[model samples]
Target: MSNILVVDDESSVLSAFQDLLGSGGHTVATARRAEAALELLKADPFDLVVMDICLLGMDGLEALRRIKEQQPTLPVIVMTGHGTMQTAIEATKLGAFDYHLKPFDPAEMLAAIDKALESTRLSRSQVVLDPETTAAVAGDAIIGRSPGMQQVYMAIGRVAATEATVLIRGESGTGKELVARAIHQHSRRAARPLLVVNCVAIPDTLLESELFGYERGAFTGATARKTGKLEHASGGTVFLDEIGDVSLGIQAKVLRVLQERCFERLGGKETVHVDVRVLAATNRDLEEAIAEGTFREDLYHRLNVVTIHVPPLRERREDIPRLVDYFLERYARELNTDKPPVAPDAHRLLQESLWPGNVRQLAHCIQRALIFTRGYPIQAGDLPLPGEVGSDRAAVSGLGDQGLGELVRRYLATYTGDRAHEAFIEQAEKLLISEALRRAGGNQTHAARLLGLSRPTLHAKIQKHKLHADTDRQAR
Candidate 1:
């Protein structure tokens, strides 16, 4: 459970937050004005603070500035019945974790609060680089002693304290974000917010408005002025993940930020200035994108000021055993079970296999292996690796015109329980969805397209099968 402070002039707002957060297993403290909230903050440390913009005395923006000054790491969620573009930008510029309009959905509010709290945790928790330590350490740590990893550490050390833009290049699941986080945590802007913008996850149509705030009536359905991530992350750091996937238009805007440190909001006349560091990561070959005219050459030059290449797991096979041990201990603690011993053959298989998905895939494999082992020693057969005989990949490979009939026959022959028809259908759907997600690199939109289903429908099916739990981290 976490401790939260809610500041609002209205008794109903405080009471609502009390009941809402209380039921979520959090200890709630209420205050009528910003003054009381600041006092409470000084008296005790809270995980998060929720405050209204229109307070009795000092307004939310002023209170937010004071709060940030007092505790730069503390996350504050600002809400108001009357919200404007200026107010939203000011709140974010003042270091508010999020800006929410009043009468917000409870589920959305809770989700935002959870994310803010997590962001606080990450900002506060130091990312340790201690490969020599044999014991498992809590929080995020970059555990590797390989030469390539050593170079990565050196690069982070060299550029972290500077304000130069850094481009981190690596394959998927190679801990690029972790490297970014490490840089931010060690940088001068460590006390400020670190906003992550995923280029691939957000659609191209909406990506511009997401990076640059949109003015009221900027486009259809844009009823209210919205603060963009770049403006909101002022005086801090913005980590752009999957940077190669961004469109040329968006890339030009981002280049302008890196060059001039200013941008005009969508459908707005005045240019807004911001002070923030940019760290970008990408798995795609951006040089190729530039050649193909999909990515801007000028933007690429701006982002490539200091390049840090994160070696994939396959390239640094020496780190696999250490990674395996660290994950085993970490996940064991999470599972509330003792770490199970891995057979020598199992370890050998893991080290020898080509990790196409990199570290994230290996972690998932270990997690699934642990679940399957169920307190027993892990054997080679327990690892549900791709391309194994009778595995999903093996079953689906080289399917011709008779593929559908063969798949149905396989399912029918394997399923022995009652309600076989329903079971078969569900299992088939799960496999198809999972495979599509895997092939799409956990991109739900792309996966949806591949499956010939709407994005929402694909999302519902993913939730039904709980596939996201396994893929979300990988996607990141």
Candidate 2:
């Protein structure tokens, strides 16, 4: 049985914990004040501590600071009858494992204690965090040797061994999810499930029920009781991809889960407590979202405990040769064909080209090139890319040496855009379409011919870029 210390000013609170925890096969010690709790802590070894914010002598926050000073790794759960955002944030920053409202659910309290004990057990293990060796710890799906990637590996090594909430910031397709997986793979909860919830893929209406689950009749089509990602992950990890897309309402609930380890399902009265670590990724700037009032500041702080920024492929072009070889070998084995040689010019072009889609795009390009490369070696001409279109090149011949695509590629190579690929493509497409429409005197047919695109394709592009109405107004 694990030894637990219960500290509170109220006699009933102490008594309730004794009865609740005692039945759960744990030995409990009670302290009426902060001094008493500290005395007990100094005198004996306890697995966990549950303390109240308001005490007879020193306040709980002060006592929490002292406890952490003496036992840095000890997990402390602080509760208050009166809760405020500042208090909650302060408790978390001061290293409290969790902070809850007073008269918290008994089940939630019990779950918190269990998690603390489990974390202690895991932390006590002899496993060490070694940066150079941690890549192998996750089985090498993350292949990179550049300084940028090396820093990423080191961050994973340092953060994986702890229960810190990680916020991975990177452009799309930069393998943010892969970094999340690597963190989970090296964690104490590696044997458990690593559940993923793509925030952008799921609609805002269904995201709440999807994450916190729901009762049998929570909403239409809710025919059966469902376990949410958080509950399902139990002792594992939950990776929230595109986390910036989460709605404000769902963001509040997510903050609760990260803070108190408890959440109630939709249309369910009982709270479902869990012990899940959170790892979230997003291409959007959460700080910007917060300033715009679309995202919660408190939730941002809770998730930003340990930030891991994954560098895009362009920042680490030196690793292209290694990554190319890895992808080529894998695809060759998968296709059951001999690995084709990559011409030196092809490799040079790949390393120099601006990869908007990062590593993921490169891997798919290799696979596609391998399929149609015929014979053996793959050359620069064999690569099928938008920049290689001769028809479009003829259209922008008026621009002299480089076309609009080349200009855009050069701009992307030199610029630092947080959402570079998407923003760059959108801006370039708009500029090209606008220039064409201007040259054609806003005639759709003439503009389409000038750009060497069919009428339907040009119209669709115009609509996609919302240039039809604006350009028509300019033409008039």
Candidate 3:
């Protein structure tokens, strides 16, 4: 059993974590203040640390900063009594092993500790397994230990030692860049930079300059000779995201870069050459594009030198629980609270969903649910799932333009265009929060789940919308 330190100001929090972890067959220590935790750190070696953000003295963030300053490699899990994105982001920036929102489950926290410990162990030993090596080579994170991910890992291993340009095909939100990154990380040029360019995000007119760089005065806006991502990744890797979205012209230029390993900068006569590994990812079917003549046949063949098609989320439903567990653990750390276990019903509901948005969407959904549930053990009843609730209309109603999605646009329009119901937005959030709670039978976690709001966020909204009283069984 590894020694773990649990720190928080509240005696109840300290006692809870100690009991939770102690019961899990791990050696656990407790400290109510950051200063005490730091002293304990100096005295002995701890495999992992469980810290709180809002401490009595020096605070968690500052204490973390000091801890990192002294031991950069030590993994510190920052647990916040309150769930705040700002705090979580700051903790991540500070290199905390992970952050968790308070009121979190003990089991999830232990899982995070295990993963963080593993990351630390791996980083220290530098003896990454074949799978991890492949994941590093592919530029995508190898998230699961399942058979599908293992195959992806093996593929990366096989192709990493080679120089062939790779075409990664997968549905949206499958982490193609992660695969790209893994390739770069495992390749001979692992130390070199891995540059990325999103082919679809930029305008066609500017893509040439962006990819190939441009000489001074190449265009009206081109004031200085600039190097592009291709040149920047000269000795490293270049990732082209959304490869299928590129126009024929851009595809032709990319083809030239791949085939000849040389391209002239825009308005520059001299040809620039770079020895870079190319990794391309796209969600669309390149064969369909080839048939439609939207994508070049030769270029597709060039990139398809070592094809790696990622399976969609649905096909790998077995990995859902794993992914869900992984993400919930990560988000709980992000929320700076204790990690929460997902209810079996919620897990099944999540598995049953089509997940049309894929992994990214799933991540978003889990995050929303975690926040809503306020780091409690999540359940199907807690989810803002469309079909689960008896009243879909009631749950979706008051979402601004009749849905939560349109609220952003409505807010933007209100701010940028004619003045409108700015006041209504707050009221809508209140009504929505109330309705979500009502549908969830006044279960805080269920209510948050119904609204797809985070615990801290839902808590704040409840207070903001003044729905706390209305939704409460007893008056506050």
Candidate 4:
């Protein structure tokens, strides 16, 4: 549970938040004014702050500025019933994690709180490079002693202090985001916010506005000015994942930001200047994309100032055992169960598997094993079946050799149910949605586009199938 401080003049508002957040297992402290909130903060540590803009004695914006000055990494959510475009912009400039109108939906507020907490964790928590030091630590760690991992560590150390833009390249589930976090955490801007923008997760139409804030009345439905991630992340670092997925127009704008450290907002004439370090990651081959004329060459050159390639898990087989052990221990704690030992045969099976999904797949496998084992030693039978372990390429090749008609005929011959057609459709839908989510890095918006479905539909299907997308380390 986290410690959250709520500052508002209204006693009812404070009591409502206290009840809402308290129900979520967070320790909530209420203060009638910003001054009291600041005093509480000075006396005790808080994981987050939720304050109103019109607090008596001292306003919320001033408190926000002071809080950021005292603790730069502490995330605060600013709320106001009299919110204006200027208030939102000022709050963002003062480093508020988010701004909300009064009487906001409890679910959205909780989601914002969770996002802010996660952001704080990623920025403040240290990413240990030594595998030996990881088992005892509760946070994230890059666990591997292989030569590939060693080189990666060296590269992060050598370039983290510098201002050069870094491009982290790796296949899906290879921990590219971990490298980005390590760089930000060890850099001169470690105390500053590290804003992560998943390019593929956001649609192209919205991506521009997300990076560059929109001016008031810039387009239809533009009710107020909105500050973008780039502007908010000024004086910090912005980790752009799947940078290659950005369109040519957005690429040119980003190129300008890198080249000049300035860009105009959508429909605004003023050129805003920002000082931010850019770290980009992508699983796609930029050279191939450039050749196809879908990616900009100049932008590629700019982002490639420093390159760090994360090797796929198959290339570093020796590290698999360590990774497995780490996940087993980590998930056991999260599952709130005694750590179970891996059977000799189970260990062998894991070591010999192709691991097409790499570390993320292994983590999910271990988590599943722990849940099913029920305090018993984990065995190979608890793991995913052999047919579930290979890459998409292997599956497609097998399908081609068998042909669709023959495959269906074989399944029909073995089937005793009359609802075979419905079963096949359901199975196909589940697999498609799962693979799409995996390819999209657990981004529901992008996965919906890939599957030719709306976001809500995709979300419902995911819920229906009880599928969990590996968002943290997958497609990094």
lDDT of each: 0.83, 0.77, 0.72, 0.84
TM-score of 4: 0.80
After superposing candidate 2 on the true structure, give the runs of residues whose Cα lies further than 4 Å from its correct spot: 1-140, 388-476
lDDT of 2 by residue, 1-476 (tens): 78999999899999999999999899999998999899999999987899998888799999999998787657788888987757865775566766667667788678767767765543333332222433223223677898998899999999999999999999878889878878887888776556677876665667787688777688886544445667646667888988876767888999999989999989888777788899999887777677766678999999999999989998998988877877777677767778799998898788877777788888888899888874389999877656742435454575645675577668878987688778877897798888999888787656755675533356667888888533343223
> Residue 285 of candidate 2: its Cα lDDT?
70
Runs in model 4 with CA error above 4 Å?
23-25, 81-89, 100-111, 388-476
Query: 2 or 3, which is superior by TM-score?
Result: 2
lDDT of 2 at 147: 92
Q: Distance (Å) between predicted and true CA of 431, model 4?
A: 19
lDDT of 1 at 463: 81
Q: What is the lDDT of candidate 3?
A: 0.72
| Candidate 4, 193-291: lDDT as tens digits | 888988877777788988997886899966556667787678799999988777788999999999999999898988888889999998887887777
Residue 80, model 1: Cα distance from true site in angstroms:
3.0
Give per-model CA RMSD. Answer: 9.8, 16.5, 18.6, 8.7
Error of 3 at 257 (Å): 1.0
Query: Residue 427 error for model 4, in Å?
Result: 27
Which sequence of candidate numbers ranks them by TM-score, best first?
A: 4, 1, 2, 3
